[model samples]
Target: MDSDELREVLQEAGLSPYQSKAYVALLELGTASARELVEASDVPDPRIYDVVRSLEDRGYVETYEQDTMRARAHSPADVLDDLQNRASRFEQAADEIEDRWEQPELDRHAASIVKRFETVVDRARLFIQEAENQIQLSASIEQYEQLRGVLADALDRGVYIQLSIYTNPDDDVELPAEEQLAATTTEARHRPIPSPFVALIDRQKACFGPHEDALNEYGVLVDDRMHEYIFHWYYSSCLWEICDEIYSSRNDEPPIEYVDVREFIRDVEPMLLDDLSVGVRVVGKDVSTGEERELEGEVADVFYEGDDYRGTREIPLAQLAGRASVTVATDEGEFTVGGEGAMLEDVEAMRLTITSASE
Candidate 1:
């Protein structure tokens, strides 16, 4: 590759422009002083030292105490290997932190509508991979038809697929001739959704769509890590404790119910007191504070009012008290929600208070 292409590749590999150029220059020149690097690489004289120091720290360059101070670049293969290793470590750390912190935020709005088909497909794909024991789907006629491919793929991969469709007077539940002849196939049992409908994948992920004209509108998919963790435990518990409630009866009941908690809360808000009850949990920390204080009792009670509703809620210290920022668990994944003035009382109320009075 030419210099520009090489520079771009280095940048994509996580090297700064100056560092890439200086390293490349060192590579070409073998061993060189900062002054030689600046001349060879066209890096400004003032910034060469900083770039060299950064490159040295990043393992792309090494410093030597010769007659005069000198720096030498590591081989290209060695540098690229170092960069790849660093990238892998960073990604692993991010994934771990996200799983620990971001899942709770997603659960708070688990029933929110999903409008984008692409998002639905992406979430559904994730749900399929996460499913372990069972998949129960209650889909609109159009959505059910559209997802035939996905369902067939899952079945082919050995996933148990159970499907239910809205009973249409004019349509049949069995696969059409063309669909049956297609490359995809599903070992699925079919039924009708009693009310609207819901899709549950191993109870780890759930989706809800409207009863009327659901295919025309959007829906939501809930596969948040925290919710998944909770559901996994719920699914694995002793049958004596909650078996009947947790396990569905294939003979009579719909495999999954479409329960929109937000709608339920909205319809029940009038009965609840003006004060809203909110609970916040600290899930993970991001910033390094040498203090070893436990996050327990870091939450505070606050009140707020709005034209629609007024309520009281507790905001976690991670949200209210700003010392070091931390990640919290949410239904979606790990995210930075609170900390450094992020927890506004009014905002929290607006978020949690369901206005049943308005319908």
Candidate 2:
């Protein structure tokens, strides 16, 4: 290599610029006095002695007295060997430091803000994988596509999922057939408004906030169940059902089924205890004809069955000219309600629907 390239290599291997130049000059000159080095290597006259001494100390050069001291560059192999030893020490120290480092657990309830999009996606993946029973998620179509693989894995693990896709309200967004087909097992829908991004797990934890952008893009993670429930309800009552359900001629069935009145009552007891009303739509199956029907209502009463809470809800029936009350048992699972043998238990799937804010 040329002198300039060799100097750069030596400096990269840990030598100072003056040391590199002096060493390279000595290699070419065979042996050189300090004055010769300054002329040949362009090292400043005042710093040449210190540079040569440093090179000698690093084992890159040897000095001998010849009236005045003269320096000789060590064999190229020897100088490189010394540098290699230094590189090895650096690697060892790095490994030791890494081993001693302890990363603290991230506080989910804390308001952590990540500005990078990649970090936001990575955190979202952790939230999905950490979910036990359910995952409630809302994102723009682009964001959803980015996380589809992680979400598919969550579903494979039997975690029930509710996904909502957000898009422009004024434009017709064509749904990708394969993407829609892949989510048949989960409750997936679309909304026209630009909804906030959200991911809630079992109503126990959540990460939610605005989309990624050049501005202050961030998310708030809540581990406190009570705080997460606010997000849960918002996801269920707003983002999840804010727009018309996406339908396709090729799609086989609806992504969601109504909860039986019995299951609905049991699932919503927490809200009742908090003196909050939860609106649920119950889809009943006709046993004889295999026909399906629905009833929308609110919880009206609560009772205890051993350790679990059971409750009742009243649904107004136009045929009966009055409201019909249905008893819901957590342990019993399903039952029948009203006059026309409209079966309430074990019909299909159950889901929460959007309700009026006042209700």
Candidate 3:
């Protein structure tokens, strides 16, 4: 290093400019009188003694009395040790930061607004490994391939997986083969237009990023169950339902189960409106007492504020945002059922199954 650069490094290493200059001058001289050090280092003559004394105190120099105060540089062992230790600590801290950035659970926010969509998607890959019951996703075909490995693992665990994938009509990108998609997803659909990337896990966690071509680029990581419910509807109404089905491991037969109450509502609402009997088994919690309930009953009715069903078979997810419920009549009594994060109903349904569908 040059003399000027050496001086700056010494200052950063906890030496004052005066101390650094005095030490450097003394080092070259082997030993120097106060007057000689002041001339060599450009330190003031009167300040030379005090600067040498300070360097000596810090173990960078040694002082002796020879007619007048004289100083010489000490071995640099201690200073080198401190600098190396600091460098090691900084390296370790950098690794820890990168590790936390890759894992969504390591982040403390229940709902995080992030600048990079890459960060949101990377963490979403980690969250997919933890899925227990379901996975709802919307992505570009390339983004789907990026997550397909972890998604395949989720599928192997019997977690229900649905994907809505989009591609630019002009881009000549090949889609994943049907068998490749079937192995990773329970159901997959092709969305004709590009949309935001979304991943919702068991109605408890969600990750979202704006479409790549959006003017404002941003992402959200949601850990709160109630907060994630909103994203679930967004995926259902805008991404999933409207897309054309391309693959399925689904059967519209009886004994069908639903992890999301909104999807259950969409399918059965028309039957209720048609005055047809639908048998259901609801696994849910009482809204008032928070006690668990497994209700086997007949569908009594369906309610959605500001919506007129008119016996419509296709109920868009938006209508369910209002005070919505599936009423059930059991041997005991009638109970109002609502979806995950439900507040207004008698019970919050975690899973609803259609046991029978009548003629």
Cα TM-score per model: 0.29, 0.44, 0.66
Report, for every candidate in turn, its global Cα lDDT versus the true structure: 0.45, 0.57, 0.77
Q: Please tell me which predicted candidate would have the highest lDDT against the true structure.
A: 3
2 against 3, candidate with superior TM-score: 3
Residue 221 CA displacement from its true place in model 3, Å: 1.9
The TM-score that candidate 3 achieves is 0.66
The numbered model that scores best in TM-score is: 3
Per-residue lDDT of model 1, residues 62-178, tens digit only: 665545667755323345444445556434433332232223222232343444333354456556655554565655556666676777677567554555444454555553443
Separately for all candidates shown, the number of backbone clashes (residues 3 or more apart, or on different chains) is 22, 3, 0
Across 1-359, the per-residue lDDT of candidate 3 in tens digits comes to: 44565566667768889887776666556556788888899999888778877876776666544366555554454555655566654334333323322332432334656555676787688789999878999999889988989999999998889999998777777777899988999898988677899999877789999988899876777888877877887787788878889898776898888877777888897777777799999988898998987899998888777656536898766676777788999999999999877888999887788999886
Give model 1 RMSD, 1 decimal. Answer: 19.3
lDDT of 2 at 69: 74
**lDDT (Cα) of model 2:** 0.57
Q: Candidate 2's residue-wise lDDT over 1-359, tens digit each?
A: 45676667667777889887887677667566788889999999999999988887776665655467766554344454444566554344333222222122344453444333344455577778776567778887787877887787887886667678777777577764655535532666778777788887755567776754326664565666667756765776678645566542222322223322333334345456567654445544444565665545554453332431123333211212222234322233433343222333333323333242122
Off by over 4 Å in 2: 1-104, 170-172, 178-181, 212-215, 247-359
